[model samples]
Target: MTEYGPRPVDRRLPTEEARDLMTLVRELADREIRPTAAEEEDAGHFPRATFTLLSESGLLSLPYDEEFGGGGQPYEVYLQVLEELAAARLTIGLGVSVHTLACHALAGFGSKEQRTERLPDMLGGGLLGAYCLSEPSSGSDAASLTTRATRDGDTWTLEGTKAWTTHGGVADFYTVLARTGGSGAHGITAFLVPGDAEGLSAAAPERKMGMKGSPTAQLHFDAVRVPDSRRIGEEGQGFAIALSALDSGRLGIAACAVGVAQAALDEALAYTAERQQFGRPIADFQGLRFMLADMATQIEAGRALYLTAARLRDAGLPFSKEAAMAKLFCTDTAMRVTTDAVQLLGGYGYTLDFPAERYMREAKVLQIVEGTNQIQRMVIARHLAGPEKR
Candidate 1:
């Protein structure tokens, strides 16, 4: 219905079901998300209603088990769905990714009883979730987190501050990591904490440049007590669990980046073709044409990279290195393409009158989140060079 874009992407989905899912997502995006994205974002309003609709429509729980209210879709199909959602609005797409990340620890490592008891509500019960791992002093060096969980008889007392939490105050539950032993990665443990727990409070959301609708804030746990049943994985295994979740989460970020890049390129193509200049459209100029061609090519390449990583993940093979590469390349591509898009649109692009500037700003944070592009390089380097010599 929104006739202000280049053309729809021709996706090669694996199954008819996947194709239908794509169509449903596109329809929903066109009708609900794409229309209000700019207005709601400008107002700094979080679309909790839309999020509830997504939950009811089964869009929020695609990559998990069907028996537990998930869609049981493969990563290959799931990431593409994420891409489509992101092309409409990055806030929703990235929020879904973060929600998936918050669910990973329990889905992958929780005991059978825990899964049966809690996974259903989490997957499709309309409960939003947040992942808490990064702290004020520890981001790239996540193992150095100072948030600690002290043990008592049957409960663990959580006392620490978690920074940069994506859903911070709004989330219904939190997947938190804290130091439970000595210093370093081996001393950490994971816990599932309710958002309403007494003494657990969220700071005012950070004033971010873009993605204003998604709250990113620090969470404070002042002697919040969690039962032993909420512990995820072994006591000393939290770091490894966090890293494993990130490997998959990076793919989610990569898909979202590609979606944003594609959206920018579509806007650029549309603007160039219609807006006239001296004699004809500016798209007639060779210089600008080449830029559009390069942007499109980069988007395709980034999509292919993430899909390849998704396939590797679906096969249950080792894909951490490829995931890092895809995240790195796709996010960097988004940043470059979105910036170039703003340039191609000339003066109007810089103004909020067009979505170009918003796309550009949103693309910037993609490179910084999930893992900074610099940290991604370190990961790739370690995979190639086989860990640094101590």
Candidate 2:
């Protein structure tokens, strides 16, 4: 295994505190994450201890309000931290994004009492979270989900299955959306369910091409009861809350995509400079040099696009269009850049002996998750031209 790790990113952080935070993140990634990533991923071992450490260090709560035990960092700063973590390991980076997404509904829309009692422990108390929305029959058409949450006085009985859940069986809590009224989007409602709630169960983790250490499983809710206090918003507001969370979550995915692309480019750069070909380094060849240059340029463009969206979010602007654009372009860039990286490493890239193959496999999922790139195009077009006709 050739020495391969993330290169130092030249970020334009807003404050000295943020810069110091980045330094700490890099040190932690280099020492704790990068060293064992390949081996652990190969063995399908989840790093629960690393996530616990992150919770203790305040990284898990960076984008929430400090009043609730969060770090109170701007979206810009929080996303850059995500990028750094993703550069080290996709499982860790994507897991953090999912956990943050799970917290969005309660943090943004829960009653004052709910926040006062639950937010503190959730944000920094070593609790992991998962978001439950997509179901066995519904993926892109989320409005058609069949999960039911029927109210019985002060309690609600939830019964449904959630597919492709990131944390699945291992999380401490779940932010779940279920149908509480008639059909379609307006019928949905959000609830915060404890992982150990009676009748809650998870299927085995899916066999995946990459990020094997991150569990992706289906969850079954068989008459799981949740108190009305756990309801995130009004009975019919779940879809809106879900969409709001996704707008920000898409930015997190964009940043992670850029991180993966950056890592791939760094690996290509390292290999090309050292591997001799025709009595000189292959990097000396014009063909490979141009490929490397293109990879770097794409990584920079993706980073800029995601950051621009993050800044818009930080500034309290309507950033849905920008978020969709960033998710679409950055993920596509990751797929392209990682493929080119494999080509640059030639046969060596395809083997498990190097990390380039893993990068390429991991990049494919970013395009599919958090609204497929095709769905993102529809979102951007809707913003530009208004909703489409039936």
Candidate 3:
């Protein structure tokens, strides 16, 4: 019989340079992230040095402008690289995604002067960023958020709590969506809040199920003062900015899901082929072989879906619906794939000895965060029902 090899598809996708970078990134993740991820997660600590290396490699700014030290790659490519990174260390993958979301407002809508001023440092090595939009009472329904930002002539004094802030305490800066007028999406405004601002404090990190190295905390904006110049755009644009950022954020989460699924699949395949049962390896069994096939299929499908949406975004088309679809499908696949990976390995998979357990734990969060899968369905359904065919 003819020898079999990896399946052939449109493998020739990303540019040569991007492929080279991906190889380097995968090697870096294998060397640096995979080894330390578990320890950091167990200790509930962030990986500062890893992020510095990511920034230095020009990975963090892959989708940003080249003039500001960014690689300026397509979101399609940028997201896949993120998936590769996440497959090694989810916390780092998410940290990069959230930071990218935190910078979305300035990149997409800010003035040229603003872009030129902040892009370099923000894209520079070792810098971190956060996006603050959620509140204790408002999550999926963000318009009803209670954070108040009162105008004081040319300054704004913000007072309220922003919940579920990623990179909460450690971020160099934050993109804050706060109330500037009345309650509702229209009444809000966005600001770039520096970490050193007076009256701004982050609560102790919240205990999480997975991706523990990615810090999550509440931010208390108690009369935090900011110059009007720091505003991301016009007044009443916070909702718009937040929505735009989230549209991008959804893709980030989708990439993360793909990564989780890929990692789980990799472990399951390795374990199945190496671990012996009865007279031979588990890979010899047809039942388990089908499971491995399913895992690989799911990961491939998820990758294709997210990359399609990312391409739409890079092409400047309306991609909100696609983004939501990708987020919903990929995250759900992650949950299912990782769960199957655990099942394939039986007792051994249930323990911390295998990464399957951690991958399973990490998969759950992707379904809930970045506009829950429920919300994603609503978004998709709305677009489907709309008059325009997009």
Candidate 4:
């Protein structure tokens, strides 16, 4: 129960309120989302129904202002919802995360009029969004993006490609970054493009080892026209918007990692407690017990790190480096925890009969997305260097 206040102001609240929201989120995740995660993932089915249910429950826009039909919750609370969602279904959780990321560009930079009119559908109900930034030639160096946005009288005609869009085909809108002037980041501009805009087409979804339920594809924009009002901030401000949004997005990914590690720990604990070995339950083994303790401890530590970063951001403090650090720590923790969970279960864990393997696969992607662990390290090191070369 964070006290209501103007945004970016850290507030005091009871832990119980966040706990209550977590309880509600968990119920939906475990009961509704988890059951279908695996099968639909295998079949590459989209979870449009889950998004609708989330919208109905007001979970999709938990961090926005109440005036726009949002839950008016703090980022700290909103991220926990993401954690609970990911623990059950990574794909749906990611879908929610990217949607939030898409909203950030508009929320952080758009005019009051834009927020009042456009934020309702995206921040409330019956809407989905994608953040489009990474291009084929520009990933870590996103400033080098070559997407062209030529102004044709009052309308902007965009021509370029966006790689690794989380909801490439299914999203209702996209927060896209393109080149509006000369080369480099200073030329970049952000736009909110509708899904059905003429000349906007998505490539076939990429074949991936995990997160199949969440569609990932390349978006191609060929002379797509948009109203000038769709511009999200001034031209050349897109890079800043993208980077800031990713700072929060990294925290979202970190929270999901914590949830995943905890889920793997839960599965390992229950399995060991029931399975017998040499006249004693496998849970009685001291070696395995120590492994579980480490996993639990890591998950707890990761949770603390991410929450600390979220609080810092809420306080209007400098938290970009901290966010990267949390993302790096938590995703690595998930990868290790899930792998250990599988080892504890032996052969069963190696197969799809159990959830451990799926968790293991999902963990790998979190490390790569929202900026790779390598990129996170760079961010941290640059912050450490003060204002000199960072």
**Which has the greatest lDDT?**
2
Q: Give me the displacement of residue 346 in model 1, in angstroms.
A: 0.4
lDDT for every model? 0.92, 0.94, 0.87, 0.87
Give the per-residue Cα lDDT of candidate 3 at 362.
94
Candidate 4 regions with alpha-carbon error over 4 angstroms: 1-17, 386-390
Model 1 weakest 10-residue run by lDDT: 1-10
Q: Which stretches of candidate 1 lie above 4 Å from their native place?
A: 1-11
Question: For model 1, which pairs clash?
Answer: none
Give RMSD (Å) of candidate 3 vs. truth. 3.6
Residue 361 displacement (Å), model 1: 0.5
Error at 34, model 1, angstroms = 0.7
- Cα lDDT tens digits, model 1, 147-217, are 99999988999999999999899999999999999999999999999999999999999999999999999
The TM-score between candidate 3 and the true structure equals 0.95
lDDT of 3 by residue, 118-141 (tens): 878888756889999998889999
Better-scoring candidate (lDDT), 1 or 4: 1
Per-candidate TM-scores read 0.98, 0.98, 0.95, 0.95
By summed lDDT, the worst window of 10 consecutive residues in model 3 runs over 1-10
Cα-based RMSD of the predictions, in order? 1.3, 1.2, 3.6, 4.9
lDDT of 2 by residue, 263-349 (tens): 898899999999998899999999999999988888888888988999999999999999999999999999999999899999999
Number of clashes in model 4? Answer: 0
lDDT of 4 by residue, 207-264 (tens): 9999888889999999999999999999889999999999999999998898788778
Error of 1 at 43 (Å): 0.9
